[model samples]
Target: MQKLRGALIGCGFFAVNQMHAWNDVEGAVIVAICDRDPERLAAVGDQFGIARRYADAAQMFADGGFDFVDIATTVQSHRALVELAAAHKVPAICQKPFARTLSDAKAMVAACRTASIPLMVHENFRWQPPIQAVRKALDAGAIGEPFWGRFSFRSGFDVFSGQPYLAEGERFIIEDLGIHTLDIARYILGDVKSLTARTLRVNPKIKGEDVATILLDHEAGATSIVDVSYATKLGTEPFPETLVELDGTEGTIRLSQGYRLEINNAAGTTVTDVSPKLLSWASRPWHNIQESVFAIQQHWSERLRDGGETSTSGADNLKTFALVEAAYESAASGSPVEIGALL
Candidate 1:
């Protein structure tokens, strides 16, 4: 099979992982790179040995030879960049928080659909090994018919150090971190019908809420809680780990902090390790997220090659993005927000 040639925009802190994952992915390779900052662009280009580099995205699209464009820039640039790729009839993989607003995300998806080009959101949380294990257990009926679930990620980790801009945003944890947990809830439980949320700005230094607890009512008649906090200081920091507790009609599934998965049903209790592999370029605590980045990117490449829809296509991500909007709205209003109305 011919490998997919990809052009990546944004040479920021996280984009480096995408570049590394692209190298590891079986059927994809980044042929070009773009970033507004010449220094950062050249640094990433040199680090990855990508000679085709650009400071302007428009110019890159104009002279494009790649099969897909990966928009790894921040949320503010997402819609415009995705639309630009759509205009060029190029398949695009956009980094999440899909857009600045749900409306913008819808427009981006519509633009790609109109152009008949594939559009995927880099929602890699569901692709994580532990999370995938939880989903698999549910699928195998080990937890026959999940009715209640809790997806939690509480950490005192200094995420703002690497991405200092995270502290500057008016909408912090819910938009940045809670979004992933929300997507995981949808992935493991099902689509959400309604959401009620409460937010708190525990950290005085940050502009937005550092903590959030959201209640979700799934369309499949399941209830779930997605609670995320960057202000939490635990005995042992589960920095990048998303712990899960799922209760089904027949049993329970627990994905603990140490990558331990436990399932208890009539058949008896079983414990298994679902740790993510540490890639040569990956380090501790972050290896889980790094592995998922490769998993999602590899999925994108395979789907792009096979002419199939991605797990988190732009259209599907609108549902997840809607939950983010509803969380903020519900948090502010102190009421439940209908997910259907937002979508």
Candidate 2:
């Protein structure tokens, strides 16, 4: 198959993993990379062997013969950059926290839809190796019919070291980190029909809530609780680990910390480790995220080759977006929010 030439805009922390994945992906090539910072541009460009580098996305988009553009900039710049990309008729893959707000996200999605171009959100948490392994088991009926589940992430890892901007941001864990965990719940169970959320700004120094508990009612009769926190001091628990508890009609599946898969049913309890292959970027607590970047890139490559669809398409991510809005609203009103009404 032919490789799809692409340009990566934004040479931020997460963008590094994408560059690595793009190298190994069969049907994709990074012909150009753009970053406002010339230092980042030169560094990532040289490392990836991408000769074409630009300080501006428009210049890169105009000059580079790329089939698509990957926008990995901050959430605040997403709408403008994506709008420009859509105007150029370039299919786009945007990093998540789709936009700063629902209206902006709607505009970006609407623009791409009107231009008849594929626009997908890069929501890659569930694609993490061990996470995918759990997803596969659920699909294979190892956990029978799923009825309940929880996705939890807690840690005090210095996430601000690389993305120091996160520490000074207006929004914290929910929109920043919680989005991934919430999307994971939606991925495993299904679209949320209703949700009740409680959020806390445990760390008063920053603006957004650092701790959140979300209760979701999935359309498929599955109930899920997703909790995320960046305030949890790491003593015994490692940095940023998502613990999943899945209860099915006839059995149960517990996937967390390493690759343990426990199945409890009438046939007695059986345990297995069906973790997915780790990516080169995977290490320590960030391994899941690293593996995810690779898997999602491969998923993108496969879709391009086979004319398939991305799991995190703009239309699909609208649901995840609704959950974010509801979380904030619920936090304000101190009550449960119905997700279906948002659509």
Top candidate (lDDT): 1
> Could you give candidate 2's per-residue lDDT for residues 59-122 as a string of tens digits?
8777759888889998878999999989999989999999988888888999998998888899
Q: For every model shown, what is its TM-score relative to the native structure?
A: 0.99, 0.95
Instruction: Give candidate 1 misplaced runs (Cα > 4 Å).
Output: none
lDDT of each: 0.94, 0.84
What's the CA RMSD of model 1 in angstroms? 0.6
Kindly report which residue pairs in candidate 1 clash with one another: none
Q: For model 2, state the Cα shift of residue 233 in Å.
A: 2.6
Worst 10 residues of 2 by lDDT: 274-283
lDDT of 1 by residue, 244-284 (tens): 99999999999998999999999999999999999999999
Top candidate on TM-score is 1
